[model samples]
Target: MAEAAGCPLSVIVPALDEAAGIAATLEPLQVWRERGAEVLVVDGGSGDGTPEAAAPGADRVLGGARGRAPQMNAGAAAAGGRVLLFLHADTRPPEDGDRALLTALEGGRHWGRFDVRLTGASRLTLLGLVGAMMNLRSRLTGIATGDQALFVTRAAFRAVGGFPEQPLMEDIALSRLLKKHCGRPACLRERALTSSRRWEDRGILRTIGLMWALRLRYWLGADPAVLAARYHRG
Candidate 1:
């Protein structure tokens, strides 16, 4: 498919059994179209009708490989846009997110991510604290996660050899590669709203603690397979 004129940005959402939430996630892309952005949905062998759910809102929907990293790579390959956004199926971009991405792209920022926030009230305060910590950490270390809704120029993505086809920590791997290529990565003011399902399932405090431990282990060179087996959902 062709890209939008002037500003070429393609948002890719990877889905796996996301029929219930895919539409909500894609709704904001309708606004993005007005700001000269294209939306592509990559389905990871979803048993549910996720493709149909995203078809109406997305500019294109392509069947993807099983894993998220591979699926995102496939989506990026199909995309004709100069800027590629890697978004999760349970995340929603801010109202001005599209404009912010284009502005960053124009400003020579090859790689960046939006701030992240979680939905729901059970752990609102805790989640806010976590969000603040994440922002601070990104500023200090130049690491960005998938949940934050990362975006990068197609050239930069290709330079880093695209995302690794791993079952876990692919976001961290890509973020490190991006940081190596582009120092002091940009951070957009727009926030991506993410689902709190994991927090609810694992309990907020426990989940947060586990994430911190995982990060520490990763930093210490622990095997990602072990961490993935311990923390991965579904």
Candidate 2:
């Protein structure tokens, strides 16, 4: 596939049964494609035809084993850009996101993530607060989540040995490694809009508590396999 002119960013989206949102997720990426960005959708055995959904919008659609980490790694391996962006299927970047990424890299920022806004009709103040806290915590801790649309230069990604092949917390593991080796992330101000469907379906309070508890256990040396199971159960 031909890349858009002057842009060298390759967006990697890992998918597993994400058919519902894949098209919407890839639609906005068309603008980036116009500017030389390539979109690669790495689907992990999605029986729901996610690859078909993404194929029309994405530059390339590749199949892989069923796991986010591994699927992401596969995309990274096939990507032909100087930079890599790992985006969730339920997230969409800001209007000028391509420019923002190029500008950040031009300004010597190696790796970073966009702030995220939860989108939905839930007028729950808690959701807003949660987003605020997430942005703040990420800025303070220099950690970026998949929902935040994490981006890194190819060199930096290789230096960090890529995302870990874990079921849960791959984003966290990548963030920690990036901080240790590349310093704090750029923490872009422009926000990516992420679907609030998860919070809407699962009780918001319950989801937050569960996430925090999982992180605590992970930090305390819990096995990722166990954590993954817990996450599935939740």
Candidate 3:
């Protein structure tokens, strides 16, 4: 059970080879933990000292299978909080993110997600439209992306069987299960700011095309492992 105003939240960051920004990504949690939030950095075999970088600020740096779904599942298993938040390593939660999460949980919903903002000044300027579109579309469809900072009650997460342990689309996949079992997720007002490294590294237009193609293929029942191959290759 949770309080009317706030509840203990466990923030799970699934990381992989993210040494460059892993420390910075987790540093905010020092304050969060003080405020009753627990932070876990679930790393999936990074060669670049990502786990070491996260150790300074994270409540726990846990190793797991090399994939976001499995890693996040591992984090959820070790969580001690009432609510479990799955955060991407490259995304930063909003100020007072724990409060935002607690607020979301009180609204007669088992799960919810924050909107997202892409970071980097120029990148934000260029991708602002894309981010806005994603937020609007996600709200309408009730399918949240991982960068959006999806959260669910521990009971609800277990009820839905956690993430699918697939190679890709786990966030959307989880949303689908929640939709069937729990109804539409509460869409929060606060937004998580995520680095635009994926779009920047691959060129925005090209990455956009690749994402659409991959999604289309996945919708057409293409194997996730095959789609993940194309995604990683791109």
RMSD of each: 2.1, 2.2, 2.8
Tell me the number of clashing residue pairs for each predicted model: 0, 1, 0
| lDDT tens digits by residue: candidate 1, 14-82 | 899999999999897898887778888999988889898889999999998888999999999888888
Regions of candidate 2 where Cα sits further than 4 Å from its true position:
1-7, 121-124
Candidate 1 TM-score, C-alpha based: 0.93
Please give, for residues 1-234, the per-residue lDDT of candidate 2 as tens digits. Answer: 233345489999999899988999888899889988989999999988898889999989999888999999999988888889999989998888878987898888789999999985333688887888889999999999999999998889989999999989999999999999998898899999998887878888998999999999998999999999998787
lDDT of 1: 0.86
lDDT score for residue 156 of model 2:
93
Query: What residue pairs clash in candidate 1, if any at all?
Result: none
What TM-scores do the predictions have?
0.93, 0.95, 0.94
Off by over 4 Å in 1: 1-7, 121-124
Per-residue lDDT for 37 in model 2?
91
What is the lDDT, from 0 to 100, of the residue 140 in candidate 1?
77
Model 3, position 212: C-alpha lDDT score: 84
lDDT order, best first, reads 2, 3, 1
Clashing pairs in 2: 4-36
Task: Residues 1-234, candidate 3: write the lDDT tens digits.
Answer: 232244388899999999999888887777888898889899999999999899888888999999999999999988888899898999988888888878877878999889888886333476886688778989999888898999998899999999999999999899999988999998887988999889889988898889989988988999999999999998
Stretch of 10 with least lDDT, candidate 3: 1-10
